[model samples]
Target: MRPHTLALLLLLLATPAATRLASAACAGEKFPAGRAYAACEDLPKLGASLHWTYDAAKSSLSVAFVAAPAAAGGWVAWGLNPTGEGMAGAQALVALAGSGSGSAAPTVRTYNITGYVPLGNVSTPLDFPATDLAADAAAGGRIRVYGTLQLREGMRAVNQVWQVGASSTAGAPDKHAFQPDNLGAKSKLVLAGKSPAAASPSPAPAPHASGGGAASSKSPNAAAAAAGVAAPVALVLALVGFLATV
Candidate 1:
């Protein structure tokens, strides 16, 4: 066999192996949803607390994050929280899809993501099911997709990102032991518009009742007002009178 032909055959045989490895460390399970992998810290820091905002109106989850470039000890890949027991195959994908007519232009290399881990462990890396995007949705699954980035170091001896649905965050020696990796380019994440968790309802007052203060003594009606009620009985009487007439 010609040398080039042998090389081609070897590459072809390794394609599936390569693809499977991309999923994650096998734990007889799958990755998580609503999570992402990136090689940058700035991205995760952009959206402070409550990175996930639930849109009760649409009955959908909206994630807001800024795609930041990779820094030292940046995030490598993302997967289901190995700790997220029972539901691993759940996944999601959040990318900075820019305005483009087609896949012809040099697209923006944003700190987007592939899937998530049910349990939260952001120290190690996971898989990116580039092919299984729809499998989850078809199975009535959901994901909390976050924007992320990742780059491979081509090492597989220890600390392999083993994502076994809802199991331990371990992997083959090749994965369990991740070599020092780096991303040597500027990657940016823009703050895209986020959807409201509810009907964008007015900000409800924080649950800040202070030992039954003046605000607490107020009543639904002055008839039951406990002195702390502002504008007291007259206000209540008018409301009750209006209701009676109606």
Candidate 2:
């Protein structure tokens, strides 16, 4: 066999058996995005994250890339702002990497994210300079993502977060949508999937009370913990193919 062909064969067989095992663990599990989380092989390298909801403004979606970081990290979101084009969606390409510190920007074979399954038709394979993307609320919701890397062995994987919405149309997929930069902050992003449980006017802060004051019943530590889950996964992507550390 030729040199490149031989290398490819080794890569397929040499992948840590854990990868397949992890894929199996994720199989049929509901992604934070709502749909059945795909198998590990089918999942994005960043793990089964993609928890999303509309922003505090209710006009935009807020997507957190991961649930918690391996240690300390933040999430990203993609949302739409241009009310134009009837085109109201955006993309957030996050760099996931490492353990502990949990983030990195690599110089790997960069490819565009093609989101989830059926939507693959709409997803386009792309390349970039290790930057993240953010569209509108709807844009961040349900979608397919994948990338191709031109490394010594070449690489490809799909990372998806399915959309969630309140559409009653039969057989209609509830899409995750966002209005646009209605609001945002550093170390965070926005995109809301279909979450009926999600509060309108914005998801109520976890510590909030129905009457209008911080509730002693709710634990602030718990909310902070949930927030951290997002950080690790955000950083995971930076590990796999990042060319450099962030």
Candidate 3:
């Protein structure tokens, strides 16, 4: 076998493993009613994901946050913390599932996390302004919360917090679990319109919720995206093997 041919065959065999490792959680995620974003990340914790677009000139950010509740009839949430890296100062958007009949759409609300207690259905205005707050249920019992936020001029990054609760009381989010995954849910979010590589393993301060013990823990969308990658990889390997023999 020619050296060049062997190299080609090796490359082909290596392709699928490379593709799968590079696959991100949101690579093929679908939004309700065909919503889209320029960038996204499979957040490292809480089985949550974030899709977003940032307009630097206008200092505006639009985001779609996806996650499932801890149980049926539960709630999920996402928020940005301007003042610190934890939940105390976070400007949050919480989503509640619809009525048992499934007639109502999931509801989205904003909460100003002043401390570590249950919000009790209070819809507090965000410290930093947000608009178009909304939520909808998705396949696999996940819920998505969408919103646009106005940020200070030239802001480049901020702390982010997300959570899931087993239930809600009177439309407010109950406390999330205290497991390691839950506690690890908060991280620094780079406000860039780029790939997921820039978002993971946050370089900012280690996350710690000030008001309550904040933490959270993954998404199912990655499997769908990875499946799409397999077809092309198989074709490449087959073609390479045929060429090597010839």
Candidate achieving the largest TM-score: 3
In the range 3-58, model 2's lDDT, one tens digit per residue, is 67556545544443323323343233233222211112222323333433222232
Poorest 10 consecutive residues of model 2 by lDDT?
A: 148-157
Q: Candidate 3 lDDT, tens digit per residue, 50-153?
A: 87766666777777899989998889999999888878889999899897797678888899989987797768888778876778888888998988788889
Local distance difference test scores for all models: 0.24, 0.27, 0.72
**Candidate ordering by TM-score (highest first):** 3, 2, 1
Off by over 4 Å in 1: 1-50, 67-90, 94-246
Candidate 3 deviant stretches above 4 angstroms: 1-22, 193-195, 198-246
Of 1 and 2, the candidate ranking higher by lDDT: 2
On the 0 to 100 scale, the lDDT of residue 28 in model 1 is 19
Q: Assess candidate 3 and give its TM-score to the true structure.
A: 0.75
TM-score of each: 0.20, 0.21, 0.75
Which of the two candidates, 2 or 3, achieves a greater lDDT against the reference?
3
TM-score of candidate 2 to 2 decimals: 0.21
For every candidate, C-alpha RMSD to the true structure in Å: 26.7, 21.1, 9.9
